[model samples]
Target: MDYKYIEQLIERYFACETTLQEEQILRSFFSQGNVPSNLSEYADLFRYESSESNIHLGEEFDARMMELVERKSGMKNKVVSIRGKFTPLFKAAAIVAIVLTIGNAAEQSIGNRPSEGFDDVTAINPYIKKDNISAAIKVKDNTQAETKTVVKSDSLLIENND
Candidate 1:
């Protein structure tokens, strides 16, 4: 058979002008082992298409894929499924949490009742004068302002280093 028509079809294929029939012809021609030397480069591509077309899934393939999908969905449903196997456990945990919170609140109220005669920790420190505390806070505020200035300068230095 004259390969001239096949060559023209190949050119049309590259130019996106070949019809489906012409492409099928090209695939059929190139799939044969006896390809001309000049067209040998295109033989592999068409042969690959032939091999791909012959590929068939196994009989159990769909079952396996669906099993995988169902497994993933079953895992996801476990997260928000309130009525499933863990429902009783979840209810017990919530009850325990509520009981603990109420117990903690009751304990705090019993202990927090204020009494006289310097029972708190603050009265033990005589050096904790209000004036000294305010002075220390002002010093801390001044140090924080200096820290902000230092941070700004350090950022500029880092950028310049980069």
Candidate 2:
């Protein structure tokens, strides 16, 4: 009728300080049907432990577990084609090619336009000087004027000789 010892053992068990023998004592004490109302709550716990300890896995248990493991492993393996494995690489290459093509086309279009905010002759030939161009035009005009004057003087001389 003194459950003080059982109570002390339970306290030690929960504290994880009880020896194996002490734990067995607690199990035996609670297994009995005459537990007081205060200790009845712990009775089911110990009785379940007692019942579960007697249970053993049958010979088929290992086979069943292995079969389940094999089934899971089989599911993990997939059939991948050569194309499937290289699909990402193919996509990356295609994207790179498209980008390069667009970049080249844009470069050509930009280069073909006339240079803006700059002189057209200078844009075409960077080495030509504005002073040299003006001097060449003056020389051409002087030569044309001299040729016209010589032709008029010659015609006048012929008319005077006749």
Candidate 3:
């Protein structure tokens, strides 16, 4: 059992100069437990590599990674649900505000209607008669008519002599 070659490879391994094949040979040699007392400390290192090479991330890791992704995606779903819940309320409020504004405008227009009643009279008749025009003109000027009346007082009594 000439370990000289393995020792040389271990020296290369420590200096980070060993090739992948040389490293595999070293791990196989140390895994047999025929290492010399001087080289026993390095045996554990090689054995650890062999064991780690055999190890793999199991299905549990994959499941956990998928769960994390689903959790993150579910947060987005909840946000969309919340927004969807409020969307109709927002639209309804906007519609109600528009309706109220239109109703208020109609009410204000009705309140501002003209007080005079003769605005629609010309719409029914385009031609004006001379007597109607004279009457309309007289209606405007009739406020200046003057009249006087005398009242008899009852406090003064005169006796009649026969």
Distance from true location, Cα of 36 in model 3, Å:
4.0
What are the per-residue Cα lDDT tens digits for candidate 1 across 1-162? 678988999899999999998899989898777999999999999889878998899979999999999999998887768467788998999999999999999999977877554334345576677777677779989999999999999999999999
lDDT of 3 at 150: 17
**Cα lDDT, all candidates:** 0.86, 0.86, 0.82
**1 or 2, greater by TM-score:** 1
Mind giving the per-residue lDDT tens digits that candidate 3 earns over 1-162? 677998899999999999999999998998995789989999999999899988889999999999999999999999999999999999999999999999999999986776564444554465756578678768765643321111122222222221
Weakest 10 consecutive residues of candidate 1 by summed lDDT: 115-124
Model 1: lDDT equals 0.86
Better of 1 and 3 by TM-score: 3
lDDT head-to-head 1 vs 3, winner:
1
10 residues in a row with least lDDT, candidate 2: 74-83
TM-score winner, 2 or 3: 3
Residue-wise lDDT of candidate 2 within 1-162, one digit each (tens)?
A: 898988888888889999999989888988877898988888888889888999989979989999999988766653345567889999999999999999999999987886663365676888899887777779999999999999999999999999
What's model 3's TM-score?
0.47
Rank order (by TM-score, best first): 3, 1, 2
Error of 3 at 42 (Å): 1.4
